[model samples]
Target: MTSRHHNLQHLKNQAYQDPLTGLPNRRSLGDYLQTALDRLHRHAGQAVVMFCDLNRFKEMNDTYGHTVGDRLLVAITKRLQAALRPDDVLVRFAGDEFVVVLEQCGSRQQALAMAHRLKKQVGSTLHVDTAVLQPRISIGIAMTSDPLTAAADLLHQADLAMYRAKRQKGDSVEIYDPVLDD
Candidate 1:
């Protein structure tokens, strides 16, 4: 590749990737969601959008400091990645928040099962320097077979569900229901 081409690629990566965890950043999520939604429109299958937030992460960060907190986020990212399929897009949406878009998911049951697997993988104990922490997560899932559903709307549903899960229990999964908005 030409030097200019390499530089452009590097810039794109920096723009789309989260520096702390090397996961796709929120900017990448918008593009990936559009593509995933398009693929779902052509194919007859359900796509799942999961909003995952780490429970008590703020307390951990405050207690340990950013260095340890950053390491913990990186560790959590690896575990979540390992539990997901290659086709899935995982984005580091914000601090202690991640968005996972699963394309071609078979059903709501499959999405729920995947959410359980993610919770299990991320709940494992971690040792970052002197801090031994047990990380937990709350996942909110929104599944859609309708091609008309906007990506932002779907993500908003999942975010609402996540807040419900966080309120009901610290580390749990909640599937989005229309009633959640009410």
Candidate 2:
């Protein structure tokens, strides 16, 4: 590719990717989710958003330091990427938090199943330097077949469900229910 084209691609990656984990950042998530929602409107498929937050992540950072915490986050990102399908979108939403968008998911049950797999994969023990860590994540999932649903609404619902899961003890997955909003 031309150097100018390469520079443009580089700029795009910097804009969209998390520096520590190389996962897509929140800006990319917004674009990808909106596109998925639009496609769902035209077709007969569902899209799922999973909000995942690391449990007791602050404790880890306080105890181990940010460098170690950064390493752990990068390791966790790799595990999560491995567990997801090739087409799934994984975004590093913020510190100790990530979002996964599954497009063309068949049903809520399928989304739930995917969430379970993610929880298991991330919960596995790992060694970063001398510190041994067993990471746990609370996952909240929201699935929609409705084309009229706004991407932000879906993300908000999933985030709400994730908070509910975190309250129940870490490392669990909860599906967003409409009742949860009330």
Candidate 3:
């Protein structure tokens, strides 16, 4: 490839990737969701957005140094990637918060099953330099077959659902409902 083409590709990757975890960033998520929405308009499939937040992450960071926190984040990212399918998109949305886009998911049940698997994977114990940490995560899932749905709106629904899950016991999963939006 030409040097100019290589440079452009590198810049594009840096723009869309999270520097810390090496996962896709929010911008990449937006682009992927837009493409998925367009495909759904012509196809018959469901998309699910899963918003995940680590429980007591701040405390973990406070107790352990920032280096340890960073290590934990990288570890969690690897586990998440391992648990997901090749077509699934996982992005590090923000500190201790990640989003997974399940493209062409068959149904709500299938999405929930995916969420449970992620939660189980994250709940596993981690050994960070003799500090055995058991991390818990709360997940909110929003699935839609609606072609008109905007990516931001879908993400908002998932975010709201995630808050609801966090309000309950940690490591819980909640599906988006219209009532939750109210």
- The whole-model lDDT of each prediction reads 0.93, 0.92, 0.91
- What does candidate 1 score on TM? 0.96
Top-down lDDT ranking: 1, 2, 3
49-108: candidate 2 lDDT, tens digit per residue? 999999999999999999999999999999999999998999999999999999889987
Q: Please state the error at residue 6 of candidate 3 in Å.
A: 3.8
Q: Cα deviation of 53 in candidate 3 (Å)?
A: 0.5
Better of 1 and 2 by lDDT: 1
* True-structure lDDT of candidate 1: 0.93
**Backbone clashes in model 1:** 0
- The 10-residue segment with the lowest total lDDT in model 1: 32-41
Q: Candidate 2: where is the Cα deviation over 4 Å? A: 1-5
Q: How accurate is candidate 3 locally (lDDT)?
A: 0.91
Q: State which candidate has the highest lDDT.
A: 1
Higher TM-score: candidate 1 or 3? Answer: 1
Counting clashing residue pairs in each candidate, in order, gives 0, 0, 0
Q: Residue 101's C-alpha lDDT in candidate 1?
A: 96
